[model samples]
Structures are given as C-alpha cells and as structure tokens.
Target chain A: MNKIIFLLTAVIVAAIIFFVPPIKGLGELAKIIFFHVPTAWVAVVAFFSSAFFAAKFLRTKNFSFDELSARAAKLGFVFVLLSTVSGAIFSKLTWGAYWNWDPRQTTIFVLILIYGAYLTLRAAVTDEKVRAKVSAVYSLLSVLTVPFLVFVLPRMYFSLHPSPINSSGVEMDSEVVIVLIAAVIDATLIFVRLMRR
Target chain B: MKLFGSRCDCVLAIVRKDFLLNLRRRATFAAMMMFALTATASLSLSTGGALLDEKFLAAILWVVIFFAAGAGLAGTFDDEAQAGTLPTLKLYGDAQAILFGKMSVAFLSLVALSTFILPIFLILFDVGVEKIFLLLATVLLGLIGLAAAGTLTAALTTSAAVKGGLFPILLFPVTLPIFLPAIRLTEISFTPAQVDSSLLVVILAFDAILILASSILYDYL
Candidate 1:
C-alpha cells in the first residue's frame, strides 16, 4: 500500500512538472501550483480533518481523537507556511511587491495568525485533556471562518490574485486536470495512511 | 419546539444576568471606555494637530474600538471562570445558550462604548459623520462579528495559563476580515458615496457563521 502510494505521487508529480504547458503570463511560475495548490488544498483538508476529529473528541471525550486533531492542524500549518511563501513568489512575479496587501494575501496572513494561535494555545496548556479540549474548540471554530477568510472576504474587494476558481473553477486542459486530480487524491491518501497507523 | 424555546429562555436569562452584573460592576465597561477615550486622545496628541486623511481617520477610529474591545471583551467568560461557576454553569441548557448570553453582553457593552466614543471621536479628531445611518449599520454589523469572535476567543484563551497577553494576539487575527469591511465602509461613510455594500454582506455572513460555529464548538471548551 505504501509503495503504491509513493509511486503514484511520484508519477503524477513528474507529469505535472514535465508535461503541462507553461501558463501564459505566469510562465514557469505557474509550475509552482503543482507544488503550491496541493499543499494548500491538503492543508485545508487537513484542518477540516482536525476539526472533524475535534468535534468527535468533544462528543466522546476521547484523547485519541484530540491527538489526531492536533497532528492534522500542525501538518496544515506547515503547508500554510509553504503556500504563503510560494504565493509571495507568485506575487513578486505578478504584483510587483512580494507582500502586497491583496485580499488573498491578507487572507493567507489571517490563516497563519489563526493556526499559529491554535498551536500556541496547544503548547500553553500543561494538562493533556485541557490542551486537547481547547485546541479542539479552536480548530472547530477556526474552520467556520476559513470559508469567509478565503472566499467571501476576498471577493468583496477587487483582487489582483487570479481567482481561477470562482463559482466556476478553472477551465484547464485535460492533462493538467488529470495530474491535479491525481495529486490531490494521492496527498490525501498519505493522511489516510497516517491515520490508519 | 418546546425545548428550543426553553433554550432561548435560558440564553436570555444568561444575557440578563450578565447585563445586571456588568451594570453593577461596570468594571469592564469603564476600562474599555477609558481605553477608547485615551487611545483616541493619544492618537490626536501623537499626530500633533496634523490633519488626518479620510483613511487614517477611519482606521484610527476602529483602532480605538479594537483596542477597547481588547481591554474588556476578554473577560466575557472570566467572571465565570474565576468565580468557579464554570462547571456549575455548564449544567444549563447548553454551551449555545451560554455563548449567546455571553456574546450579547459583550456586544452591547462594546456598542455602548462605541455610543460614547463616537461622539468623542468626532469632536477630538474633528471628523464629521457623513453617512450616519449607513455608518451605524456598518458599525452594528461589525460589532456582531467582533463580539461573537471576541467571545469565542475569550473562552478559548481563558483556559490558558498565559491568557492576558494571548487574548488580543488570538482575537486580532481572527477578527481581521471583520475589521477590513468596517474600515472600508467608514471610508465610504466619510464621502457618503454610492459604493457597493457587498462588503457589509460579507461581514454579516461571517458574523452569522461565526456565532453558529462558536456555539457548536463552545461545548468543548
């Protein structure tokens, strides 16, 4: 199972880098999405995973569920950091400034602040159960605003960031689409595999 | 249906109880109101009578409100936490009622502070209220988001050993989106121009989702 997962991720990733056409305007910079989008999508999915287990933990008062939530949030934070940096690179290419206060940029900053606080809250508590309880609550509550922070709030402004995925997602060529779909599924399987462990 | 009505009663009861307690002590209100005034006054002094542009004016007004919220809103659950009534209070209808009750008090208290501070802000800063009704609507909607997010954050942080400093740190970022539209609206309010109100819709929707989510998550805390 593990070998198949690794092989699948490897094949899809290689295809993304070598096969997809360099985007117009974005040029090679768009290649980062193969890296950037999956990390972010996983990060978001991981946070939701965290929140799901958090709700479960709260309902059952089970420590294991809390443990899963904490790991997922922590993993999400790493991808969040990577995506923000990659986004800054993209911004530098397109927006002139690496850190323009664009709506999407601001939303990324907000996400950092949020999970940063979540991690800090987790670390601050000495009691395991208390740590789990508080972190779980934060995770669940934070997810509620994630949609607003990422979607609604950004749209209220005229954003410089390319909103390739609006109510309608990007109209990509089939090859790029196939690669992306595979990458997302494979990345999530890593989490599925980890959870099983 | 009956059970839901009973839950509403419980929420109202908690709201009333908090209001009465807050009225008697007025500690948080005084603290926050004073903070708002001095923050406003201090900003005036710092600028040294230089004329602020419309953006700075809108921004600073909310800086006052945000810091003022920081001053007292963290205590939303502090009274119960400190009094050791938290465990006992959880025996009520649910965390939803308790959260609403706590949220209402915090919302009203901040609104009251805004009521007092807005006039003082106008006089001290020498800015006029261009769109009073629109401004009030913006402020009211902004407060709902601020208060709900604030109350939920307060509950999250009140458990920590290092809560005092962490409150604003957590609260600020979470409420960033809420702050954005209000500043934009305040800017529009200055000119009373016919700009889009899609921002207000975003903030209101966020507030509704936040309160509902907080109520759902409040159970764990």
Candidate 2:
C-alpha cells in the first residue's frame, strides 16, 4: 500500500509540474505553490496530530502513544523545514530577496523554532516516562499559541505573500487551485503512511 | 474554608522559604543586575552617548532585559533540584501551590531586576520618557509574561538531564511571541503616539494563558 501510494503521488506530482499551466503573471515559478503550500499544510496537520497523541499519552500513560507523538513531531519538523526552504527559494525568485521578514516568513521561522525546541527537549531527557510527560506538556503549550501565530498575527501585518485563499474569496486560478488541492491531498497521504511506518 | 486557608498558607510558606533562600545567596539577583548593567554600559560605550533613535533604544532595552532574564531566571528552580528537594516537594507538597510559590518568586525577582535595570537604561541611553505611565504599564506586563513563561520553562529544565544548557534553548522560542508585542509596545511607550491598547491586551492574554497552562501542566511535570 505504501509503495502504491508513493508511486501515485509521484505520478500526480509529475502531472502537476508538466501538465498544469503556469499562473498568468507568476509564470513557472508559481508551480512552487503546489509543493510549498501543501508541505506547510502537512506540517501543521502533523503538529496537531502530535499534540493529539501527546494528550492521549498524558491521560493514558501509555508508551505507544508517546512513541507515536514523537514520530509525528519528527515528521512535522521535516515538513516544516521543507516548506521553509521551498518558500525561501520562491521568495528569492519573485520578491528579489530570499528572506524579507514578511509576515508569512516570520510565522514560518517561529514555527520552525518551536518545533526544533520540542525535538531538542525530547532528546534532552534520559528517562522515557519523564521525557514523555515533559514533551507532552510542551506540545500542549505549542498548540495553544500556534493558532494565534498562524492566523491572527499574519492578518495584522501587510504581507507580500500571495494569499490565494482568505475570508474575502479564493482569487486563485482554477487550474492552479486544482493542482494545489491535489498536492495537498497527496502530501497528507504521504504523511499518514510515514506515521504508520 | 479550612482547606482554602491552609493552601494559601502553604503557598505563602513556600514563597517565604524561597525568598529567604534568595536573600541568603543573592547570586542570581546580583547576576541579573550586573548583566543588565554591563549590557547598558557596553551600549553606552559603543555609541559614545550619541543620540539614538527611540525605536532602536527600545529594542536595545528589551534585548538586554530578555537576555538578562534568560540568563538569570532559568535558575529559579535550580537550587531545589540540586538539593534534591524537588522530589520531596513532589511527594509532600501541593503541585499547584509549589508552582504558584515558585512563580511568585520568579515574578518578584523579575520586578526587582527591571526596577534596577530601567533607571540605568534610561540614563545611559539618554531616553526621555514621553509616556512614563505607559512605559511602566508595558514593562509590568512584559515582566509578568516573562515570569509566568520563565517559571514554567525553569520547571521543565529542572527535570532534564542537561539542565542549565537546555534552559534557553527551550525558553527563547516559547517566549518569542511574548517579546514581539512587548518590543513594539516598548517602542511606542518612548513616543507620544497613542498607545495601541491591543498590544497590552496581547501580552496580558499571553501571561494569563501561560500561567493557566503552567498550573494545569505542572501536575505532569
């Protein structure tokens, strides 16, 4: 099943890159949205799952839940790093600077920082039970602040980010939206498969 | 009524005990003050008293306080951990009361640290306080946020194997959201501009949330 899903995702990605038309003004560089946005989305999903598992661990005192939570966090951290690098490359091409401290940029940076701290914290403790409890508490704290960071803080700043979706409307081209949605679904599937492993 | 009174007394006793311990050692307090002073002196010496933009001064002041607090506040629970009293407290003491007592100590020390640092910061940097009351309000909220978040982080670090080294790594990122609004508020406090009351609300919200979270989560820790 994993192999089949992986192959299917690869094919869909190839189709996205080759068949989908470039955005009118953004040109081929807009293809990045398919990869970047979905990765970020997956990272957010993974983090919340990690927190969910952590909450479960705290309540049940089960080591298996702790293991699942740690795995989810690790996956989330990797996806966040991928999204950041992809976003930076896209930023460099379009905005003339790799990192402009845009609201989106700052938000991602903080996310990465928090994720890194979570992993470091997990590694620092020697005892398994203690580590699980400590990291669970930290994960709960992270989830509490993350919504404010991602949703509210960015709205306060004037961003150069092409916010294709917002409360106002979805301004994205239909083809681009299709490809982006497909990528997001594929990425989420990949995340689920990895978590099972 | 009896339970409430005894719980309050327990908290007070822990706070008083920690206060006396703090008074006797005085190292962390002096270190926080000295660190803040040294940072101010270095900034003063570097710019040679040249006039600085208010925004820059505000950032500098927060940077100093943030780092000083980061350097010093992580040790709030260190002595207890070292003396192996943490387990005893865990076994015999109310987790909530111990947390509150430790948080109270941290808050008091942060207040004292800011009090000592602010005057020198103003004199050395030649900052004319355009809104003294606003400055005080912002600083007070910032310190509360710091103390609330810092005490929780200190508790966390106390349990880790690499105690001292891991404190800032865990504390800094968790506290960034608090500092971002705080630096902006501090910058505005230096200007005559109408304060963005929202920033104060944000810090207040974070302080309350952190304290509440710490209280709930302290049980597991």
Candidate 2: clashing pairs of residues:
none
Q: Is the docking of candidate 1 incorrect, acceptable, medium or high quality?
A: medium
Give the least accurate 10-residue stretch of model 1 chain B, judged by summed lDDT. Answer: B212-221
RMSD of 1: 3.4
Worst ten in a row by lDDT for model 2 chain B:
B168-177
**TM-score for each model:** 0.85, 0.95
The candidate scoring highest on DockQ is 2
Clashing pairs in 1: none
Off by over 4 Å in 2: none
Residue B167 accuracy (lDDT) in model 1: 80
Chain A (alone) TM-scores for all candidate structures: 0.88, 0.93
Task: Give the CA lDDT, 0 to 100, for residue A155 in model 1.
Answer: 66
**Candidate lDDT values, in order:** 0.82, 0.84
Task: Tell how far residue A163 is off in model 1, in angstroms.
Answer: 4.4
